[model samples]
Target chain A: MFKRLFDWLRQPLGLIAVGIVLLTVFSLAAYGIFLTQQSSAQPIQFPHRTHVGFGIQCLYCHPGAARGPSAGIPSQAKCWGCHQQIAKTQTSALLAPLKQAVESGTPIQWVPVAMVPDFVQFNHRAHVAAGQNCEDCHGDMTLVTIAENPQVFNMGWCLDCHRKAAGEDEAKLLKLADCGTCHY
Target chain B: MNSKIPEIKLSEEQTGKWGMVIDQDICTGCQACVAACAMENNLSFVGEVDAGYGRSMHWIRIERFWEGEYPEVKMTPGQPMMCQQCGSAPCEPVCPAFATVHSQAEQLNLQVYNRCVGTRYCANNCPYQVRSFNWRDYVRPEPLPNQLNPDVTVRRMGVMEKCTFCIQRIHKAEDKAKSEGRELTDGEFTTACAQACPANAITFGRIDQPESLVSQLIRKHGHGVKHLEELGTLPSVTYFKGG
Candidate 1:
C-alpha cells in the first residue's frame, strides 16, 4: 500500500492538482489584501461629482467645517431637505436607502473615508479659516466616484506643510508643529 | 569651560510665558481638581491594588503634611502638586526618546505620548515627583469611558503622563482666537482644575502680561514662591503662601 502511494504521488496528474491548490490559496490572499487596502463598502453610493456639478459646496453638506473641529456628516434631515424634491422617484435602487432612511427616521451610517488617529486633534475650522481648501488635504473630491482618503495624515506629512508655512508666519506655524498642538 | 551658562533669550514671538498661581488660602482641599483633571485628560483609574503599589495616576495631587507637636498639632492645608512646567526642566534632558520637552511656543513641558518608550528616567530625575508611570494597561470600564474628553488621548500602558496645564483647552482657545484674527484674552481659557475649582483658587494666565489676573495676583502678593526654589527648576506654577 505504501509503495502504491509513493507511485501515485510521482504521477503528473497528482502534481498538477497540488500546484492548482497552492495557486488558488496565494491568489485569494493577494485579493484579500488588495480589498483591505482599497476603500471599504459605504452605506450609500454618494456621488460627489453630481452634487458638485449642481453647484453644491462641500460645506453645504458638512457645515461643521466652518464652525467646529469636525467636518461632520450631514444629518438625514439635511439630506432629505434637498433629496425629497430632487429624488421624487424613490423606486430607483440608488435612492432606495435614502427613502427607507427618511421613512424609518434612521440616519445613514456612512463609512468614514478619512480617519485621523484618536490622538490627533484636527480642527477643520482653523484650517478653513487659514485659507486652506478641502482639496488641499482631501484631494479633488469632485472627480472621485466615491470619497477616499487620498492623503495619509501622518506627523511627517503635517510637518512638511507646517515647515513651509513657518517661513512666512513663524509664530502661527510654530504652534502648529508643537506636540501639544494636535496630540494634547 | 565658562564659569556660567549662556543667557537664554526669549524670541519676539514668545510674548506670553504661560504660568499658574494657586491661592493656597482658598483651596478647600476637596480634591475636586484631581477628579476634574483625571476626567478631562482620560487618565486611567488604577484599582486599589495597583494604587497600593504606587501605580495610581494623578496629574495633580493634594499633598498634605502635619505641622507642630501633640497638643498644638495642625494639618497644613493640602497643596496641589503638579508638573511645574519648569523653565529649566530636569526631566527634559533625561528622556532618551525626547518624549518630554519644553515647548517655547506655549511655555509648557509637553509629554509626547507617542514618542515615549516607558523609560522612567524622567520620573526618576524629577525632584517634585509629579510624573506618573503606567505599570499596567488600565481599562476605562464601560460608561466611564463615554465621558472622556475626545480632545485628549487615552494613554496606554508603559507611558509617563503629567500635568499639561490643560493643553487641550489652550489649543482650542488659541485656535478660536487665531481663526477670529485676534489674541487670546485673559480669563478666556483656563486649566480644568481652574475651571472646576469652587473657591476659584487656581488662576492660570500669561505671566508676561502684567495686567493678567495671574500676574497681578503674583504682584499683589509678593509672597508667591516655587515649591522647591532652592533646586532652581524655575517652575511656572507659583504657590501663594497663606497663614
Candidate 2:
C-alpha cells in the first residue's frame, strides 16, 4: 500500500501535472510584467484642488467644456490671466515652471493621463449640459489634489453611467445609450 | 399643409423629427460641406490616390453634374448627398446584420459599427451612394492628431460608415436642452455641413415640426423630394432644387 501511494505521487503523469501548476503560477507573475510594459503611466500631476479651492469651477481650467467635445486645457496665457499678479514674486516649485511658460508664451506640455481608446467618443458638453456634476464621471475631483488616472474609463464605466441615467425617467431622451451616442 | 402651423403627435415624448433642407440655388459646389462633414464625422482621408479609386469616404459630397462641356460648359451647381433618414428606409431591410436601424424617439438611421460585418450590401442598396467603407486605419501625423474630436470615433479598417446627421451634435444639443428643462432651439443642433455652408443653404431641424424650416421649405419646394423617391428610400434629407 505504501509503495503504491509512492508510485501514484512519483509517476511521470503526476510530475507532468505538478509542472503544469508551476507553469501557470509563473505565467500569472509574467502577466503583471506585461501589464507594466503596456501601461507606462507617468502623469504630469495637474493640481485640480489648488485651482478649484481658489474658487475656480471645472470649466475655468478645462475651458470650452461647456460648448465643444473637448474640455480644452487653458492656454498658458489663461494661466497668466490670474497667476501673473497673484504669485508674481513667489518662486514656488510648481509656480516657477508655469510662470515661465506663461511669460514666454510657451505652452505647458500638459500630458493626458486619462486616455480613452480612439473608437470611443466621449463629449464633455453632453455630460456637463445634462446636469451631471463633474463628480459623476470624474469622481469627487474636489477631493483630488492632483489629477491621476483614478478610474478605468473603459466601455463598462461608460455603459454603467448610461444605464443608470437611462433607467431614471427624469434624465430625458439624450441620456439614453443610443449606439450613435458614443460610436458615431 | 399649412407650412408654419404646428402638428401634434401623442405617441411618445414631445419630440421633433430632426431634418435638414439644402437649397441648391445657393450651393456653390465649393465642397465646404464635404470638408466639414469629413472633419465632423471623423471620416478618414485615404490620400489622393485612394480618393481617385473612389475609396474616399465623404459622408456629405457636393456632386457636380455638368450640364455642358469646355468654355461653353454651364456647371449647374449640385446639392450635397448625405444619409437621408428616409421614413421608409431601403437600407434598413437589407442589412444581413441589423447594424443600421431607426431610433424610436427621433427619425434618425443609427449606424452601429461594432455590429456591422462589412457585407457592403447596405452600400449597394443605397441609391444616394452616401455610405462609406473604411479600407484601412488612417491616422493623421502627430501634432495634427491632437486636432481630432475626442467625441467622434476614428473608424478602423473594413467597416461601413456614413453621416448620422451629426447625431453627436444633436445629442449634445438634446442633453443641453434636457438639462435646462426645455425643447431644443430652432438652430441649436445644426450639423457641421449645415453650419459650414457659406450660403446658409442647409437648414437642419425636425420635419414633423410644421413650423420648422425643413417642413416650411418642403411645403414651398413641392414637398422637396428625396433622390430616387420612387424606390421608396424615404430619405430624411429633402433638397430644394433651384438655379
Q: Highest DockQ among the candidates is held by which one?
A: 1
lDDT of each: 0.86, 0.74
What does the lDDT come to for candidate 1?
A: 0.86
lDDT of 2 by residue, A55-77 (tens): 88887778677876677767778
Instruction: Tell me how far the alpha carbon of residue A28 in candidate 1 is from the true structure, in angstroms, after superposition.
Output: 4.2
Provide candidate 2's TM-score on chain A. 0.67
Every model: Cα RMSD to truth: 4.0, 7.9
Residue-level lDDT tens digits of model 1 in A70-144:
999988789888887874536678878888888999999888888888767888997888788999999998787
lDDT of 2 by residue, B86-123 (tens): 66667777988888877665668877787788888888
Locate the minimum summed-lDDT window of 10 residues in model 1 chain B: B7-16
lDDT of 1 by residue, B78-190 (tens): 79999988887899999999899888688889899889999999999999999999898888779887898888888888999999989889888988897788999999999
Give the runs in model 2 whose Cα sits over 4 Å from its true position: A1-108, A125-136, A139-150, A168-175, B1-16, B25-30, B64-79, B96-98, B114-117, B139-151, B175-182, B196-200
Task: Count residue pairs with overlapping backbones in model 1.
Answer: 0
Candidate 1 CAPRI classification by DockQ: medium
